[model samples]
Structure formats: structure tokens, C-alpha cells
Target chain A: MKKYFLPSLKLTLVTIILCSICYPLLIALIAKLAPGRGDGEKVMVNGKVVGYANVGQRFSDDKYFWGRPSAVDYNSAGSGGSNKGPSNADYLKTVADRIDSFLVHNPQVKKEEIPAELVTASGSGLDPHISPKSARVQIKRIAAIRKLNEDQLVTLVQQYTEKPLLGLLGPEKINVLKLNIALDNLK
Target chain B: MNTEMIGIIATFLITLILAFPLGKYIAKVFKGERTVTDFLLPFERLIYRFCGIDPNKEMNWKQHIIALLSINMIWFVYALFVLLFQGNLPLNPDGNPNMTPDLAFNTDISFLVNCNLQHYSGETGATYLSQMIVITFLQFVTAATGIAAVVVLFRAFAGKTTEKLGNFFVYFTQTLTRILIPLAIVIATLLAFNGTPNSFAGKDSLVTVQGDSVQVSRGPAAAMIAIKHLGTNGGGWYGANSCHPLENPNYFTNMLEMFAQVVLPIALVFAMGFFIQRRKLAYVIFGVMTLGMLTFMIPNIISETAGNPAIANMHIADAAAMEGKEVRLGVTASAYWQVVTTIISTGSINSMHDSAMPMSGAMMLLGMMTNCFYGGVGVGILNYFVFLIIAVFISGLMVGRTPEFMGRKIEAREMKIASLIALLHPFIILAGTALSSYILVHFPDAGWAVKPSAWLNNPGSHGFSEMLYEYTSSAANNGSGFEGLSDNNIFWNVSTGFVLILGRYLPIIGPVAIAGLQASKKYIPEAGGTLKTDTATFGIMTYAVIMIVAALAFFPALTLGPLAEFFNLK
Candidate 1:
């Protein structure tokens, strides 16, 4: 026991330095070459930093494109989901309420056109992307509020839409932060 | 197939293809044959010299157990103290407070056992220094520990009757240098470029385009996230784990993380085949495991993609299962990850398990309950080997002949150890759940940090499932939780802490002991009377043994929790 314990402790001590210290240090050094300088990539508008390119934002205004309902309200520092079970009565009522409110805000948009992603809270509560269908469904409301052409808004959503890997894998998603930023800039 | 389905299928196929070569490479490394990774010998020698370890010194199974347990003991003690006082430690820019003794006990044991069942949120509960030194450090060594433990079994099988299994330190260090470190660097590099933060920066405050103020947490996440998957240790940098955009970033990264966790477990199976000079045996084992995985995976995918029935009642358009899921990966990809993570025991979730459909929950439970369908790291194959022993023994009983495996007869002692290990899993899981349930019903106001009444996040049957899931995760060492369960209290922490130790060590000890005993037995060459353990019939028998054991032990408990919820889903 003594023979094994001594060596085991020594080896673990050395291993800690190698793994916990040197490994992450090496990775951090190489990460200097990555975007955002490894401090998280920032989304800048002109000369001012608005937010992170990957982190979602709260967009409750009727004039802008909104992402999915975030359980954490897009507080990136404390990210999490609703964690409400599928069979929970209160959770189902919350989903129903989200649907009704969407119809109230966008009376022109029929209930059948509302994508589920828009009504439901994302797992991370910081989902930057929305389904392309989610983006398309909100075009009319955004056009009416911003006084922009509906076809122009649809084209913007199309242009901002990100395709699946090799166009044959994953779902087609549009980055809502990028889309809404473009909306504010569009004539 | 739909694009999401294509995503799921392609991920699985690509992993299997890559695992073949990786398996052969791993076997070569363990056998001390020359390979591309030989360049790492100098570094390995340095680690050996510094630790005063003679890599050539071999040990019997007993010494190997002593060495493994002692090292884990050192880790648990050191990690517990550090976690208990992490607030006072340096690099805590986020100012997360120190953990109570109970939560620290649970957290330390969880990561030490390679479970990574985080009772506390990673972003809020842990500091940067603790994350690097304790959590990420445990991820590396614990995974290497598993690889080393399995290699002892490999060396046992490679030789005739003998006691010289292998040097534990040699296998441990070489695995770290030759396999885990190189693979981790590649995965970490890919993640760093793909938007996962890879620096020492603290949380940053920013205003959105919509003029909303938000504080975004940033850290040395890319490095930790890489090994978190590479080692099949699924504790995430953030509370949401891989679901967070910065942690997983995108679909390609999702596929990469999924592939990273699975490839090693599959490769280890092939490695066992190569080490034993029986590739066909490996194929049979692989076939059985893949089939077992698909049985759970298919139901999970169908249920998750079908959308939740409760939301379907809302008469809303687009009734896809989007709650607690991301749009980028969609439900199909999320469901695929759910099965892969649980079945493999990686437990890094991209979708919230608490909100998944009832059928999906049942499949996840079965995945953990079986716990051997392409399991965690090297331990996965070890668990399957136990099941194979039971199958061999049962079949021998059926035919009135002695059961033989690899060249040795399956005697009573080996059978006893295997049976105990198998029973231990269900016993710990069910007993822990039962205790929690009893507390909730009888002593809801019992004075703990968090009362029993506040333990559940969802009510009725789903809530019962949460208690069941917590224990199952701990006992299986799978680590992914229902998330909604408010389990950061003394009762949960203490109860699951003991469960984590027994779940991890006993099964490991049982397998190692059996392998050692088998190795020391007189080797008998193949004969006509011996039941051919490598045939397709044996695979079916082994699969039957696994399903029967899991179903028999867990079906009633599962019926009460997930099945009840499913039938009552509006």
C-alpha cells in the first residue's frame, strides 16, 4: 500500500500540473490567433460594440425581428432553459399563453403560420438563431411597424438565412440578432 | 430523409468509420508497438521519472486496484478542499461563493468518478481556477484512469495463464500523452475558432442592438469543453452545458462534440478485439451494442421529433418539439444527442432533458439503466464484458455444458462477481430513488438546506421521474440530470455522494477482479464442447441478458415515473 500510494500521489501531482496548468495554458496561447482574441467575438455596429455575435438579445419591440423566448431573458451570464416538463400543466398553459400573445401582436399573421421555436424557450436561453420559418412569419409585422416593404423584408430574411452543413444536414436557421441589426439599417 | 435526420445518420456513420482505425491505433499503443504517437515517449518518460515510476514494472490485479483507488483517494481529498473554499481561491473574477461541505462532497465525487453530475451550475458555482485545476483536471485523469484500468484486462487476455497484467502507471501516462492530449488539442482548436471562448477573460457587460443591458460570461471554456467531451466527462462551462451558443457554437461543433464522446468508447471495443487477436469477436460485440443503442435511440428520435402532445392541444401551427431545444440543430439532432450522451454516459446535453417528451425520457432512463450500450470510455466495454459472462453462464445452464470465454471456463467465483456487479447497479439506483421518495412523502418538512418539499420542480409523475433520474444518473455515473430537480441540498448531495462512489468503484473492482481470476486460471484451448462465444447466437444471448436485466430491474419504477407521465400527457 505504501509503495503504490507514494507513487500514485506523486504521479497525480505531476499530472495535475501537466493537465490543469500546461494543457489549458497551451490552448489559451494558441487561442490568441482565434477570433475575438479568445475573449468571445463581439458584434460591433460602426464604432460601437453592441453585443456578442453568438449571444442572443431580448427583442420585445414590434418593429424588430425577435428570436425564440429565452428562459433566462438572454442574460448570458446565467444561461439556462425553462426546464418545464412536456406534461406539466403550468408549462402547457405558458406555451398556450405565448401563442395567444403572438397572435395578438401580429393580427395579420395567422395562428397556423407561427413556428413552435418562436413560442418556446430555448435550452440555452441564449439561442442567437431562429428558424427561417420563424423569421418569415414575422416579416409582415416588422414591415408594418418599420414602414418597410414586405418583399424587401422577406428578401432580407432569405439573405440572412443560414443553411445546414453542406446544405443537406441540420436545420435552416437565421441569426436573429444579425437580421434585426440589418432591419434597423434597411431603407 | 429530412436534413435533421441526415444530420443524425451522418454523425453515426462517420463515427463508426473513424472508430475502426482509432481502435487499431489504440491497441497498437497498448501493445507497445511502434505507431505515429511514439513521438510522445520522451514526455511519458519525463512523467514517469518525475513520479519515480518504473513503467516496466508489472502488477497483478490486486496491486492495480490498490494503485487506482489510492490515486482517486488523493484526488477526492484535494478536490474537495479546493471546492469547499473556492471563493477564497484566486482567479475567481465572477465571485462565485465557496460551496457547502455537502455540495462539495457531491461535486468532487461526481467528477472524480467521471460522472460529471454537477449539483451546482458551472458558471455560477465554480471559479476559473477551480474549473481548470479541479474540474477540468479530473476530466483528464479520470478518463485516463478508465483507459488504464481496461488495458490491464487487455494485457490479461493477451497472455496465457499469468499474473503479470500490466503496469498501471505506464498505461495511465501513455494514454494521457499518446491519446487524450493530442485528441483534446485538435478538438479544442476547432472549438476556439468556432466561437467558444478560449481565454482567461472574465464576464463582460454589453448592451444589445435593442438597447437591453446584459452581462455575458466568458472564460477559458474552449479548452475545458474540448476535454469535457473528449474524455466523456460532460460537465459544461455554463449551466446549460453544450446547449449554450458559446459552448457548442453551431451544428458542426455539435457533431464534433458528439463524435468525440462516442469515438473512444467504440474504438476501445475494437482495441479489445485487436489486443485479444480476435477481430470477429469485436465485430459481434459492436453489432450487439449498436443494436441496443438503436432500440433506445429510434424511439427517442421519433418521440422528440413528433413534438409534445400537450403543446399539440394548443391548436398552434408548427407543433414541433421546440421547448428546451435549439432551432439550429432541431429536434431530430437533439434527440440523437440525447441517446448518444446518455447511452455513452457523456451526459453533455444540447437539449434540456426535463422538457423532452415522456417517451424520450423513458428511452434516456433505459439507456442509463442498461448503461453498457457503447458506454463511457474504457468502462463501457468492461460493463458489457460482465453482461457477456452472465450470458455465457445462462447459456451453459440451458445446454448442460460448462461455459467458456476466451480460453477459460466460467466458474462460480467469476459468475458471483459478475452477478453482484450487475445487481449492484439496479440496487443502488432503485434504493436511492426509494429513499428520496420516502423522504418526500413522509418527511417533506425535514430540515435540510433545501427541504424535501422543494426538491421537485415538476409535479406528480414527472416529478417522481426527476427523483428517479437523479439517482439513476448518480448510480450509472451518467451525470446528465433532469435539471428541474432542486437537488443542491444536504440530503441529495450526501445521498448521491455515497451512491457515486459505490456505483463507480464496485463495478470497476468487480470487473478487474474477475479478469485477474480468469487470467490466473489454467488455460484450456478451444474444444468442440465449448460454446462458441464469438458467434451471432452469443451476441443475441448477450443482448437478451442485458435487456432482461435492465427491464426486469427497472421496468416497474420506470412505469410509475415516465410511463405514467406518457399515458397522462394531454
Candidate 2:
């Protein structure tokens, strides 16, 4: 044990240098060539940074599209989900409340028409994307408030909606921040 | 098939296809055969000389264990201090404060053991320097430690009564240079390309087009995330783990991370087969493991996809469970990740386990409880080998003959070690739970950092499951959590901290000791009457043994936690 001590210590130090210092530096260097230069990809408008492409931002107004319910209220400083168990009365109540609020906002839509992602707090609590169905469901409220053509808003959503890889994986979804940004661009 | 299922199938199939060649490469690496990675030899030699370790110097099993544990001890202490003083340290991009002593203890031990059970959110809990040095650094070494230790087990099978189980430093260094580092570069590059942050920049403040300002936390996350999965060390750069968009990015990277975490564990099984010159036996073991994974995995997929019954009863349109799940991942991928991460003990999650349906939670618990179905890196095979030993002994008893594994007699000493190691897992988990339960019920207001009454995230049976999940995860050295549990309090931090150490080191010691003992015994020649341990029959026997052992130890606790919730929901 005594014999191994010096070697083990020396080896651990070298390993830390290699793994933590050298390796991360190398990856960070290579990341320089990547999109956003390894800093988060920012969605820019009029040369002004408007949230990260990946990190979700909360939008509570009726004039714009909103993302999924946020457990952390879309606080990007830290992230998390509601972590509510399916059988927990409190969590179910939270869901019920989300449903009630969604109904009040989009009274033209039936309660059953509410997409689950719209009401459920996403795992990251900062889910940037909502299913295309979720985006469409909000057309009536946004159109009524912004006085925009409903069809025009619908096409704008389709434009921002990201298709699944090869249309064979994942769900078709729109980044709420991007969609809302584009909505602001409409005359 | 639906596109969601397509994603799941592609991810898994790609992993299986890739595991074959990777396994062969790993086998060659440890066996000292010439390979593509031989270019790394000169660099490895430099490390050995600098560390004053003779790469050719072979150590007995006892020395190997000592060397492994000693370094791990150094790392544990070093990391604890770093976390406690991270606020004063450089790389304070976000200017994160120091961790409480108890939380530091839990975090250090958790990462040191490859458990990575984070009590604090990564964004605020650790500075960038600590993230790289402690979390990312420990992630690599701890995984390499497991791979290094299991190489001794390989020699035990292939050797003819020898104590030269190869040099621990050589295997350890070689694993990093040849496998983990190389793969990390590729994976990290791809992740960076797909929107994971890579800059040293601190949190970037952005004004949403809608006039709301937000702090977008950024750091050197791509590299940490790569090895975090590759090492099966699932500590997250963000509080939300892989569920964080920057951590996972998209479906492609999600599949990439999932595939990355399982690859080595699967490869090592084949490496063992290649090392021991028994491909058929490896298949038998692989078969039982896959069967076990699918058993729990399918139920989780069904439950998660069927959605929460409680939510369905709310008359909502969707029946699929999406709470604490991302829309991009949908249900199938999230469900697959829930089972795969726990079963492999990688513990990376794309969704929250806390919000899973009662049945899904039970299955996740079962995955960790049976922790050997394609477990963590090299540790998985080591664990499966212990079950193999038990199966061999039981069958030998049934046949009224002396038991033998790889022509080595299974004596009382070896059996004692194996049985105790097997028992230790459940012992620590159950004992820890009982203690926590006692504290919560008897001393709700114990003068701890956080009172026991407030420890749990949910009420009633679900809360009980939270306590049970923490212990089970610690006992299995699985770091994934029911994150809803407001842990980081002294009670949880201290209790689970102890469980993490005992759970990790004891299991490694047990397997290495058993392998060493088995190697030293005389190699008896094969005979007509010797039990054919590599056949399908033995696989069934081993499967039965695993089921009985896991069910017997954990069923009542499951009943009290997930099962009660399950039936009540019905």
C-alpha cells in the first residue's frame, strides 16, 4: 500500500491534467469552429440577441406564442422540471390548473384539444420547443389579440417548425422563442 | 412503426452494431495485441515514467485493489476541498458560491465512486473550474478505474494459476488514451456542432424579442457532457442533466448520448469473451442481460407511452405521459432512457424520473435493484460474473457435485465473498432506507440542515419511493435521481454519502477478490461430468437466480413505494 501511494498520487495528478485541463481545452479549441463558436447559439433580431436557440424563454402575453409550462418559470440561470409523480394529488392538481388556464386563454378550443406538452412542465423546465400541434392550438388567442390573420400565423408556425430527422425520428416541433420572434416580425 | 419508435430502435440498433467492433478493439487493447491505438504507446510510456510507474510491473490482486482505492481516496479529498472553496477559486464565470460541507461530501463521494448523484444544481453549485477539474476529471478517472479493475477479472479467466494480473497503471492509462479520450473528442465535437455551449463565457444575458431579459448560462459543457456519458458518469452541467437543451441539444445528440453511455458496458462483455477465448459464453451472458433489460424496459415504455392514468382521468386530450418529458423526445425515447440509464448505472436522464407513472417508477427501481443488466462500463461484467458464480454454486449443489467456474473450484472462501458482496447491496440500501424512514418519522425536526419532514418532494407513497430511490441509486452506484427529492440536506447528504462509498468499493473489492481467488486455484481439466456452464440452460439458471435474488430483497419495499401508488391510482 505504501509503495503504491506515491505512484498513485502522481498518476492521479497526471490524469487530472490530461482529462480536465488538456482534454477540455482541446475540445474548447475545436468548438471554436462550431456554430455560435461554442458559446450558445443566439437568435439575433436587428443585431440584438434574443435568447439562445436552445434555451427556452417564457412568454406570458396573449399577443405572442408561449412555450410549455415551466416549473422554474423558464429561469435559464438554473433549470429543472416539476418532477411531480403521476399519482401525486398535488401534481395532478397542478396539471388541472394548467388546463383551466389554457381553456380561459383559448376558449374557442375545446379542453380536450389541449396538447399535453402545452400543459405539462417540460423536463428541463426550459423546453424551447412545443409540438407543432401545440403551436397551432394557440393561433386563435394570438390572432385575436394581435389582430393578425389566422392563416398567416398558421403558415408562420409551419415555417418555424422543425421536422424530425428524415421525418423518422422525434416529434415535429417549433422553438417557441423563434416562433414568437417571427410573429413580432409580421407587419 | 411510429417515428418515435423508429428513433428508439435506431439508437439501440446502432449501439449494438457499433459495440461489436468496439468490443474487439477493447479486448485487443487489454490483451496487449497490436491495434490501431498503438500510436498511443509512446505517449502512455511517457505517463508511466513521469508517474514512476513501471508499465510492465505486474501486481497481485491485493496490490491492484490497494492502488485503485488509494488514488480514489486522494481524489475524494481533493474534490471535496475544491467544491467547498470553489467560490474563491478562479473560473468563477457565474460567481457560484461554495457548497456546504455536507453537500460537498456527498458530491465528492458521489462523483468519486462514479455514482454522480448530484444534490446541487450544476449551474450554481460549481464554478467552471470545479466543473472541469472535479466533476469532469472524476468522471473520467472513476470510469477508468472500473475498466482497470475488471481487466483483472479477465486475467483470472484466461490465466493458469498466476498472480500477475497485469499492471493497473498500464490498463488505467491505456483506457483513457485509447478509448475514452478519443471517443470524447468525436462526441464532444458533434455536440458542440449541435448547439451545446463550448465557450469559457459566463452566463450571457439576452433580451427576448418580446422584451423579457434572461441570463443564458454558458460554459465548457460539450466536453464534460461527452465523457459524462462515455464514462457512464451522469453528472450534469445543468441541474436538469441531459434534459437541459444545451446538454442534449436535439434528437440526434440525444441518441448519440444514449448510445455513448451503453457502448462500453456492452463492449466490455465482448472484450471479456475475446480476452478469455470464449465468445459463446459471452453471448450467453449477453443474452440473459438483454432479456433482463427488456423485461423492465418494455413495461416502462408501455407505462410512459400509455401516459399517466391520473392525467388521463383529467379528460386531457393526450394519453401519453409528457410531464417532466420533452416534446422532441416524446414518450418512447424518454421511456427507453429511463430504463437504459438505470440498468446500465450510467444514470443520465433526458426526462425526470420523479414524474414517471407509478409503474414506470417501480420498473426504474427494479433496474437499479438488479444493477447488472448491462451495468456501468467494466463494472457491469464484474457484477454479472458474481451472479454467474452464485448460479454455478447453486447448480453444483443441485447436481450433488463440486462446483467449478472456468475450471477453478468454487470453495467456501470464494462463495463467502460472492454471497456477502451480493448481500451487501441490498443490506446497505435497505438499512439506509430504514434509517432515513426512522429519522423522518421519529425526528422530523432533527437539528439537521433540512428537517426530515421536508426532505421528500412528494407526499405519501410517492415520497416513500423518493427515499427508497435515493438509497437504491446509491447502493447500485447509480447517480440518477428522482430529482424532486429536495436532498442536499445533512440527513440525506451524510447518509447517502456513506452508502455511496460502501456500495462502490465493496462491490469492486468483492469481484476482484473472487477473481483473484479463482485464478490461484488449480485449473482442473474438463470432464464429461463437469457442468456445462456456457450453455443456454445455465443462462436460464442465471436469469432465475437474478430474478429471485432481486425480487426477494426488494419486493416489499417496492410494494410500500411504487406498488402502493400503482394500485391506488387504479
Judging by DockQ against the true structure, name the best candidate: 1
Please, what are the lDDT tens digits per residue for candidate 1 over residues B1-570? 789888989999999999999999999999999999888889788888888899888899999999999899999999999999999999999899999898999999999999999989878999999999999999999999999999988888888999999899899888888899899999999999999998888899888888888899989998899999988889999999999999988999999999999999999999999988988999999999999999999999889988887777777776798889988878998999999999988899999999999999999999999999989998888899899999999999999988888899889999999999999999999999999999999999988778899988899999999999999998889999999999888888889999999989988888999999999999999888989888999999999999999999999999999999999987
Clashing pairs in 1: none
Enumerate the chain B TM-scores of all models.
Answer: 0.99, 0.99
Q: Weakest 10 consecutive residues, lDDT, candidate 1 chain B?
A: B309-318
Q: Give the poorly placed runs of model 2, Cα more than 4 Å off.
A: none
lDDT of 1 by residue, A94-114 (tens): 888989999999999888888
lDDT of 1 at B432: 95
**Residue ranges of candidate 1 with Cα displaced over 4 Å:** none
In candidate 2, residue B489 scores what lDDT?
81
DockQ score of the complex predicted as candidate 1: 0.87
- Residue by residue across B1-570, what tens digits does model 2's lDDT show? 888899999999999999999999999999999999898888889999999998888988998999998888889889988999999999998889999999999999999999999999988889999999999999999999999999999988897988889999888999999999999999999999999998899988767766777788889999999999999989999999999999998999999999999999999998889999999999999899999999999999988888877778878778668889898778899999999999999888999999999999999999999899999988888888889999999999999989998898999998999999889999999999999898889999887667778888899999999999999999898999998887888878988999999989989999999999888889998899899888999999999999899999999999999999998984
Docking class for model 2 is high
